[model samples]
Target: MPHQSTAPPTRFHRSIFARTVLWAIIIAAAITACLWLLTDATIRNTNQIALERAVDLDLAGMVDIHASGGREELARRIADRIALQPRDGQLAHYLLADTAGRRLAGDLRQWPGLHAGVSESGPIALPGGSAFARATQLGPDLRLLVAHEDHDIDALRRQVALVYVTGGLLATLAVALIGMTAAHRLRTRIERINAAFRHPDEEALARLEKGSLDRDEIDELTRHSSEALARLGRLAGAQRETTDQLAHEMRTPLMHLDNRLVKALAAAPEAETAARIADARLEIRHIVRMLESLLDIAASQARRGDRHGLAPVDLSALALRLGELYADSAEESGHTLKLAIAPDVMVEGEEMQLTRLITNLLDNAFKFVPVGGTVELRLAPGPSLTVCDDGPGVPLADREKIFDKFARGSEPGTQDGAGLGLALCRAIAERHQLEITLLPSTRGACFKVAPQARR
Candidate 1:
């Protein structure tokens, strides 16, 4: 099938770090508001208590002055106290009133309308700004009012507000920093774990070293992944050994059989007998080729994610050279070969393996194209390679299946192939971290081989 690329859907809350930071900010704001309200209420209560205590002290002083020296002495004492306080920044006001609610003497101009006992009065217009008065009854016919300027309490409130605001901002910043740091660490660890899974070899496992005993979720994951990779390595090793032993055991007998068939054909005198011997030898040779192809597939699969043998290869040059080498064969088969390759298109891969991969693609294209049809090999930027032929395109139903070993296209009987060509191509592409897929074309087949990044 023509490969189709689908992008993963995006979600807003995908990042754990972002979610954590958002929640942290919300919680911090709530806590900050609650603390501010509590602190504000406590400070207001304390201020009120201090103001009331001062009023009570003033009332007591006025009563003592009145009892000791009568109204004349009481008025004189009040005037003296008022005079002692600074006029420009007076915080306290005192009012002495008689039975008829007339101000006797004090800084206050009139008797405040209040019930008997201590009562608070707000923002009463004063010379500077505003004042709050605390009134108390000193006698059956006498009343005393004490007022303090509101600026002092307002200043105190402002200071407390500043502290609350500063604290709230610092707390929010600290929370954000902590959340970001934690998120970064988590993402890094997750990426490392993903890499280990992609390359499940001893080196990848060794890199996922055992963490501390008091392990977190990430550490535990690493531990488990290491164990899994180790197990996978053992299994792969066993499979490779088995493949090697089977190849050896099978190829030895096949070699002996081929030798016996050759000797039989040489000894046969009759033309019919010699023809039968030749047919058997051809079948044996086909089996031997199948075995070799199978071994190549196994080796390619085993080398996936292993870069030890990789080196820089000029893919453009390789494609052009192969096209030239196969030109004579194409002409012999009554097909035209064309090359449109750009120079200096380098890639990191095994040169021998990459050559085989390209060769297989070109061979398959040539095999399917009819006489007088054109097979073109093109190399372009992104280090992409393509082999296109004006042949019957891959059927939609068989496109995906054609990459499987022993899978044939719709016109299978028209072509002579073991059908492992595309499968081997896929194996080689995977080993080099490349992508190979059939591209949709209107009248022909176009197979693309390119780096994964390009895909």
Candidate 2:
């Protein structure tokens, strides 16, 4: 035979940290892109404004000098003055031209073919090669032109470059810090998981669960794991109890069958046959009841969420109807059954589930009450239902246990049930977000189911 798989079963398992980090990196990239767009727009606008102002200032001085008719002398002086200024030649290299398109005192071999005012003129080949020119008309026939170097706006380029570099560096730094913090917390959580996985033993789990490490995605996983362990512990205890109960329940019938067989063997033949048949019928009924109880438990668990849809239910009317249905049975059993339903009581729930919940409580009351005992069903405007019986009430210690699957307050030898009625009742009530509790009673079991107001 092929080897069977030994891997543990799991529901959707994956790393939460990986998902969180991936999302963080994506968000950081988006922020960086947005910063680049805004910075680029601002820088370009500032550079254009500054370049226009520089041209205007230089043009004003040139126009004043040319209008005075100080042609050759003024051009020479202007060039000399430009050379002496701090950022004069540094801002732009000049190429001055006279009115008849003649080269003047600046660097150009000829006029740049424009009587200009802050306009683009480019690809003007000189001894060096092609270049870009920013020219402005200075006089009737004289033009003053400024051309940037062939290296292509290096200074302004550097400023934009620096902005991006700084922005990228900052983005990288932030991402690194976030990634480091995430990884550190992730490592701690993985360590805890490893420790818990290796020892699954309580002490290790307790240390991991109780110790407040750091708050991150890992903390969520650790908390979930802790909760899962607690649930598993409860499930294990319940399983043990169920196993013990099943064994005990099966043994009783088997023992009775054995005694019946022995008794039949020693009796007269005619009576012996009848005695054996009766014993057989009893054993069959016991087995059938056990099977029916098991089916009910399975059905209840399967139908847990089938009643989730909202429906308006009149609680008081339903209680009154159930009270009437059980009245005759209660009288025949020599127990007094009474109903006290408040007017206009309503709730939002599945009518069938609510009905079943009430029926189970009344069933338990009827089972426990002795002859001439009283069972009362009460409903009030408080939107609560209470059932009380005049029988031995449940002990304080067994209150919670009585609602557990296959649990009963009394010993199995005395009770005639599979011990699932109260558990089913609790499940049905809880599904509707109703609170059911064992209330204090004078001499009998009293229980209440209180539902919250619906919005």
Candidate 3:
């Protein structure tokens, strides 16, 4: 009754939507990181090269000016640089000093101690930022130093990194949205195929058989599966038809033979001869019962999972009515029929078939248990019915085997039965989408009918 969930149901965490989001995030992060690394490396190298060139040219020009016109001319050029770009002075260092270490007309607090004589170049700290610098001992008297600040380059790198971050976020969002849409459509298509099998009908089957002209693996699978189902349906229909025809053909003659036996019993000259004829008639009756039971099993099997003719049946009331009807029989057999029935336990099924299912279970219990034994029938909220008998319980070996058609229990008293009762009970339960199981019992055989979900 409780069928398995969808094939795609359990692994939802690994679905297309989830995988797409994960991969999108990974790709976006990788790209953004690579760009940031490249920007930092390239800008660092360019900053170093730039600082070297600017300082080299400034020192060269100062050397020529100081050699030709001494400290007067060199100091004038440094002063012109400071006056033209005051902000530039924050990044571009300038200094000119005499042998006494007294500053000339340039923007420097004091002449810095340059370690590498002649031409010095390396990283140096300045107020508010860091920089790369080059210093020179010009003409052994007037010193000139030049440096370039890196705060502007650091700000530029951060701006580029921000742009990359925004782009990665947008990429992740866009891929996530696209993945959801694709997963929805793909999941819907898969569910459509599952629905056809769950509640198969002419239209759904036909649709599957026709399939899509689209070039996809799922569509191809549907087409192949539909063909298989069609084949199986044809085979099952033929088998049922042939079996029904044989059952029908054999029924009339079996009835006529029984009627003839009855007539012969009436006309027999001696009590012995009449007794023999009566026994024959009894055997004939058993055969007829077996035949009818087989037909019922076959009918129920054919009707399995078909919801067309079903309606809500009050199973509680039905059990109550059957219990009352069997009370007389139970008393005659010196057995107590105890019913612990709940109210309004409804089920979806044919009343006649459900009645037969319960009837067969009751008959099996009554047959197995000896006189003076107790038989209990329970009805509960799950529309669950259980019939248990205080008889020699079914052997463990035959428990599962006994449900098969024509499977007889190996216990001593089981021979008289045609072994169709439990088989028919199983078929009827399945037809109503319920499961009947041989529950574990301490003292007797107990059979329970309920939906699979409860189990």
Q: What lDDT does each candidate get? A: 0.80, 0.69, 0.79
**Candidate 2 overall lDDT versus native:** 0.69
172-282: candidate 3 lDDT, tens digit per residue: 677767876777777776766776775566777887766655579988878777777677678877988898888878888888998988787767658888888888888
Error of 3 at 395 (Å): 3.2
Itemize residue pairs with steric clashes in candidate 1. 1-399, 1-400
Span of ten consecutive residues with least summed lDDT in model 2: 1-10
Flag clash pairs in model 2: 99-141, 116-137
| lDDT for 372 (candidate 1) | 94
Arrange candidates by TM-score, descending. Answer: 3, 1, 2
Candidate 2 deviant stretches above 4 angstroms: 1-16, 78-100, 116-156, 159-170, 183-209, 212-243, 246-250, 266-455
Predicted candidate 1 versus true structure: per-residue lDDT over 42-110, tens digit per residue:
988888777767776776777787788887898898888889988778887878887687888887777
Candidate 2 C-alpha lDDT tens digits along 7-43 = 2232222445655666677787777777777877776
- Give Cα distance to truth, residue 122, candidate 3, Å: 4.6
* Clash statistics: count for each candidate: 2, 2, 0
lDDT of 1 at 289: 86
